[model samples]
Target: MFFFLSSLPELFVTVNRQPRGRICFSFLWVEGGRRGPCNPTAFAMEQLSTANTRFALDLFHTLNEKNPTGNIFISPISISSALAMVFLGTRGTTAAQVSKAFYFNTVEEIHSRFQSLNADINKRGAPYILKLANRLYGEKTYNFLPEFLASTQKMYGAELTSVDFQHASEDARKVINEWVKGQTEGKIPELLVTGVVDNMTKLVLVNAIYFKGNWQEKFMKEATADASFRLNKKDTKTVKMMYQKKKFPYGYIQDLKCRVLELPYQGEELSMVILLPDDIEDESTGLKKMEEQLTLEKLHEWTKRENLALIEVNVHLPRFKLEESYNLNSHLAHLGVEDLFNSKADLSGMSGARDLFISKIVHKSFVEVNEEGTEAAAATAGIATFCMLMPEENFRADHPFIFFIRHNPSTNILFLGRLSSP
Candidate 1:
């Protein structure tokens, strides 16, 4: 019974992380309006559902690799709903009508699923997970983007006079930052850091995701000390690394030539574990094997009825920061969401006869790890979903160790990162 409750969070996270099937169209409802035949509300809701599921799944998969262990928490509904509204771009009567027309049976179902998952985690004494999804049903914000832009012009010291919704401008960027700060509990920083918003910006969608949790087995500060860290084969540096030795629920398994380790978190609801190849000589093959075998199904099977042991192990990890920015227009296009990026795509429910289409998609993520724990922030923006496929590099994070922010029952990953040195 103890093990069953402990494994629940991973189960929930895993289920949430699984790639979803095509959305069922039966839930959408269309109504007559000045925009001709528009269903922006339905479209927005559907998109939110799909994005939330995908984000939850991707986060888990990335975090639950070999070599690290940690915690992850998030408000998936909040981030997904915010992104959906920005994409819809509804205004005035059309906005109000579309809001009324949109129904959320699917959202309710997801809430129910999360609630059940949370209950299992709570049984294991994990922090209560709160989604805060009601913001979506509240008053809309993007409808006022025009007014917000006008105010920006008046406040600007310069005589910048151009203000159009089709192209996102500096003024547009300011509006988005203000909105994001209000929604994300001030977790995200500089949302539009690259001046990606402008007047030609017909639609702007933003999602801010945050995760915070306590470690199951907290590391003692006295155990932390300076150590040597290898950045690569030729470069080695000395840095502070935290160390801990305890009896832990650990697993060692070989999947396609890589040794995967499972480190259970407190309450056994979640875990922070890592996978490293036995043959570090062939780093490329090791990373490929790890990725191929990294899935919720295999993880679930592995953790079920596992062996427990008290092992004397020295763990050293550094405090590090990572920030990355990506343009996701190309990624979304590859994902079959191309219509929202084209003129032919109908977003009439947002505004009457508005020739609106997404022009860009941007993503930024940051992570910090120290003796205390881990902190991370990520944001995704879609103006017009285009296509950009970056080359995949070998996942050779052959440093000290890696950590993952994960929910135990669902195995949903909030974040995944590595700590090379202190």
Candidate 2:
């Protein structure tokens, strides 16, 4: 049965409502090569390119496990580029040495090499990464590294020193901001408002994820009518509910006591599937069951079967906005990246040792849903950019609905978020 499930057409979706495709931009510099002078910057760039691809795949699995109903966007360019600057600062390492340490004939080679290692890291570090990803992707997330550092220091009760979060260059800040805007579809504001650029802060790393989609059987706008929504335990508010009546790729499993719907993207490379509990009144149980049963691998297996058929569905999703921020220093430190945070650590590749230490890591995200479709964005500048778009649909999220933005070709998730209330 599972084997049959794997035969269904795959789909990929994005936030911009366009055809799904893979696009990447990168810059490299190799300093002080044995033949002559290798561009250290090039070596650092290569490292970022390699590391980010690995990170993206790992992140996809982590997010897929937690919330399989949404889109995901990741900016390897921003994260790798910023990390490259930090890599330059590492001590006892020449461009040639660094290049040799992370050997690769092509960018794809680097990705393949680190892919498995990143997966291991994700498995062990799921909680930390998910918390960080969610907070960083939240709307109103900070833009400066120092602010992020300070916040993180306080959160983790880490001791602060004078050497932390110096400053970044204007050029670096601009580049980071551009990546942020690009990833967020111009929704995030004031990414680098002020005091965000300086020389001491030479690099920034960022990653953004998002997910949204329409119903397999879309609700007609005419059917959409104002409905009262309950918030928390008490607050009741009126909201629009989109109604639809059509056959959908759906399933009702007694084991899980829920109904499932699959929403396909433009290329059929990915789909945003939703699992609603039988007891809609008890949202927690539904959410919990969905979380337990929905794994990335399982979804891939289930969607492969052709048993799914059209069924009637009345969809109601509320418009919602959630903003969160994170300080990644502690998170990275927890991930065994403590050396980079210490002044004693070598970073001569970027500049002289004792001259650099990570100053900050900031992230922000936003989302909006209307009768037409869904729009969302996320930004990380210290620095990062992750953006995606897919075909338009009649997916009016009037009631609580789950969605996922995914890549059909790679089965990679770029972003994942949920809209429970307007």
Candidate 3:
């Protein structure tokens, strides 16, 4: 199911689904507001985006340390959306821990910023398909607070659904998975498995994001050829390499020793930025080193419109596909969110009593890049600088590199990945 915002004023679409294929739709009149550009200097979304970027980089480094030789793909927005809903119902130390770890200042700030961003992206006339969905599934007998449900719908556009997890956990799993699958256009079919949700589970928060778009400047299919992509300084493998030479918004940083390139999508609202290290080193380690020196201030100084030069670049990027799933419980625990998963978790704000704690955070992502464009989807359940210049401006991504699909207006990263061998 999708949403369309037309010229008609004040419309709220609420879709509630029960166990099995039962779906009920309700529409409410929502008053419209003054439409204007969100000022970057004062808006909470910009500040949140900056803080979230740092957190995303930190998480990327953590994941990189764990899997040195493998590929990495994740959606911070997806995971954060799920956890943000959980954050709405936290208090005291639990809330403080999660707020600091997730880069959220307050529950209201998180909710408002997300609501504004969602409204901006969901506007009509967008040339691509970008869908974001959130759902809260509670056991039939669990008495979730009314304020919690109202806040989720008002701020995050999420709806609560009652499922029979108390008696049939397997069936509840299927119901949630089917909703996730529909949200991601089947790119993420199975997000929850047998043991993830059980009879004891009181609540499960899930978020899914899907994006598909063609390139603003399409690459020629005939130019794509087999080329050797260096896995490391010593190892190499031949892969299908896509070639495109165009004048893109590009920049260089001497301190970090990397080149930045931004390739816009058809709508120009979102784009893919790639960072290629100057040396042919392990991309994971290279990425970690670069990430260490990265600050939001320095990133702004580098990628700022006045800083980048639209130089013609010979780009040779390998065509690749990646689909990966991760259980973020341990990762969040390691990152100082230790209270939420254990007995110390204080989720009293979700329910009147202190009875709710996060059970599992299941995240899965899929991405495909070819000559035409990109198709990527991600689902989450409860979860750089430089200066430089010089010789040839050829960005031959024959080695490992980092890439991000970000919304240009809000500067929110929808997807982040590393192409190690692909």
Q: Estimate each model's TM-score.
A: 0.55, 0.51, 0.85
lDDT scores of the candidates, listed in order: 0.36, 0.36, 0.66
**Position 316, candidate 1: lDDT:** 43
Ranking by TM-score: 3, 1, 2
Greater lDDT among 1 and 3 belongs to 3
- Per-residue C-alpha lDDT of model 3 across residues 1-422, encoded as one tens digit per residue: 01111001001111111222111111100001222476433456666676567667767777776886678887776666656666787898899988888888732367777787667656767898887766667778877789998998887777888988769979987987687667667766556645655666666565566788899998899999999988886788999999988888888877667888888899788888888887764433356566565555665565655667877888888999887666566777778887776556677786666644554454566788899888887611110434555444788888888888888777777788888877
**Model 1 lDDT at residue 203:** 34
Candidate 2 segments exceeding 4 Å error: 1-108, 112-185, 204-219, 230-236, 280-286, 292-307, 310-312, 321-324, 331-337, 344-355, 379-402
Q: What is the lDDT, from 0 to 100, of the residue 395 in candidate 1?
A: 23
Candidate 2's TM-score: 0.51
Alpha-carbon shift of residue 274 in model 2 (angstroms): 2.6
Best-fitting candidate, scored by TM-score: 3
RMSD for each model, in Å, please?
15.5, 16.5, 8.1
Candidate 3: which stretches are off by over 4 Å? 1-42, 106-108, 281-288, 379-392
